[model samples]
Target: MPKITYITFDETQYDVEAKEGATVMETAIKNGVPGIEAECGGACSCATCHVYVDEAWAEKTGEPGAMEEDMLDFAQDADERSRLSCQIKVTDELDGLVVRIPESQA
Candidate 1:
């Protein structure tokens, strides 16, 4: 299991150990994190799982795929760091990852 630290715009933070292969949004929902609403379950159709990966951990999470990239155009504040959490497959490399919920999502 890998631990994910989710931080909200208000600076609230929560840490939880997640299933080895579950998406980051799944882990956030399971831990009752304030933001992160996986509206489309683990599907990439919705931008509700939008999150901003901390600059320090950006490379570790990698970039979004074509579908996710296209979907993100509808997000509130799509930026270089914006990502659909449901599209992220968990891995040991993502441990201690810091994801900040944007004000729009919060």
Candidate 2:
């Protein structure tokens, strides 16, 4: 399992172990991490699962596809590092990934 850290706008953080194939949003919801509503349930239709990839981990998390980028427009505070957690699949390389949840999702 890969260990992922989710940092909230309030500065609170939750570190959870996730299966390699699970999406970041899935791991978050399973662990009851706040700030990720995931309203679209892993579909690329909603931006409720928006999160900011920590600067150091941004490149590793990769860029979003066209559909996901479109949905991000609806997310508050969307920026270059912004991503839909539901679209980020967990992998061994992401073992120590850190993502910050926006205040809007709070």
User: Candidate 2's error at 49, in angstroms?
Assistant: 0.2
lDDT of each: 0.88, 0.94
Q: Candidate 1's residue-wise lDDT over 13-80, tens digit each?
A: 89889888899999999889977887889788879889998899889898888999999998898899
Cα deviation of 93, candidate 2, in Å? 0.2
lDDT of 2 by residue, 53-106 (tens): 999998898999999999999999999999999999999999999999999889
Clash pairs detected, candidate 2: none
Model 1 Cα shift for residue 75 (angstroms): 0.8
TM-score of each model, paired residue for residue? 0.95, 0.98
lDDT of 1: 0.88
Clashes of each: 0, 0
- Top candidate, metric lDDT: 2
